[model samples]
Target: MPKIIVEVMPKADLLDPQGKAVAGALGRLGHSAITDVRIGKRFELTVEGEVTEQILADVATLADEIFSNQVIEDVTSIRVEEAQA
Candidate 1:
């Protein structure tokens, strides 16, 4: 099986409230060096077939359509690799 990894993150121009809160908390906990933090999501999907260009294109479509929200979030990267045994 081939595994598809999708990473989604907020757009740079957008304000990330959760990330800001975490950064503030980290600073209060003495991790002041943590200047910025952006929270994101990762998705792992197994496709029961060979990894091909068509499959990758389809995965990209799925990432843009289903896994991520184009308004607030952007799909940063999508990788397809063989699953570990």
Candidate 2:
């Protein structure tokens, strides 16, 4: 099986409230070195067949359509890597 890794994150043009809140909390905790915090999600899925362009495309489409909200986030990247020897 092929493994798919999907990284989802908020568009750069959009404001991330969760990230902002985490940053604010960090500041309150005296973490001066930390300036910003961005929230994102990682999803790993196993495609039940050989890794191919069509499989990759379908996985990306499914992730965007169901796993994430396109309104608040964008699919940053999709990587298909071999599972382990």
lDDT on C-alpha atoms for all candidate structures = 0.93, 0.89
- Report the C-alpha lDDT of model 2 over 1-85, residue by residue, as the tens digit: 7689999998888999999999999999999899988899999988787888888788878889977898988999889879798
Alpha-carbon runs more than 4 Å astray in model 2:
none
Give the TM-score comparing model 1 with the true structure, all chains together.
Answer: 0.93
True-vs-predicted CA distance for residue 8, candidate 2, Å = 0.5
Task: Choose the strongest candidate by TM-score.
Answer: 1
User: Where does candidate 1 clash, by residue pair?
Assistant: none
The estimated TM-scores of all candidates read: 0.93, 0.86
Candidate 2 achieves a global lDDT of 0.89
